[model samples]
Target: MNTVEWSETLLLDFPPMDEVHHTFVDLLALAQAAPDETLPQAWSAVIDHTVRHFGNEDDWMRRTRFAAADNHIMQHKVVLNVMREGLGLARAGNMAAVREMAGELAVWFAKHTQTLDAALALHMRSVQSDAPARRTNRANEHPVSAP
Candidate 1:
């Protein structure tokens, strides 16, 4: 089975996202290489990281009002749900199902990172860049309630 190795190509240029994604990649690597005896634990680790990673991104999207937030969030929901299903499969002695899901996830991740996630990073950068400007302009504008 092909594993998704972390590399420069996967860097989203957003530190927080990158860090989370790095952890995810590493955890996923462990799952990919795990022997049958430990595959469940390794896969569980990946799922744990994924829960947080996807939550953070989804939160950012909603907070930043990213244009595609709904679509992006739905994708996250679907992927996460499918991954969760793999856990049940693993527990049910369906190791093969878990293995296949892991391979498919690797492929899904690379594409999702480059496309949906890349767009999110760009949107985040734009929002963050505008924040200071918005703050700076506050003093120059009409005060809502001067304190």
Candidate 2:
């Protein structure tokens, strides 16, 4: 499996988002390493984490009135649908599909984090600075080094 290697380059400098993203990377690794008999459950956990992760970002977009909201949400939806399909295939004993998806996801995840998610994190910070009361105070919670 082509696993995503979490690195300083992936940091968004936002605690909540970074925490979720770290969990995402870990979950993806779990899915990638899952044995054939346990792939279904591992993949399911990834799906669950992904839904929550996407939902959190969607909420941030809605709150901040992000200009690329529609496109971002659409991307999330499409990816989730494909993941769900892969889960189904895995349940049907097509573990290869899930493994393949995990590899593709490693590639997709690095690109997505560098682009879309990075933008969102910046936007959220901008929103926080522009309206301190509207944004939750999570910036100091994770203490990750910024890129």
Q: Give TM-scores for every candidate, taking all chains together and pairing residue i with residue i.
A: 0.92, 0.88
Across 38-87, the per-residue lDDT of candidate 1 in tens digits comes to 88888999998899899989988876678999999999999999999999
Give candidate 2 misplaced runs (Cα > 4 Å): 133-147
Q: For model 1, where is the 10-residue window of minimal lDDT?
A: 138-147
Clashes of each: 0, 0
Query: 23-122 in candidate 2: lDDT tens per residue?
Result: 9999988889889999999999999999999998998887668999999999999999999999999999999978999999989988999999999999
Candidate 1 clash pair list: none
The runs of at least 3 residues in candidate 1 whose Cα sits more than 4 Å from the true structure, single-residue gaps closed, are: 140-147
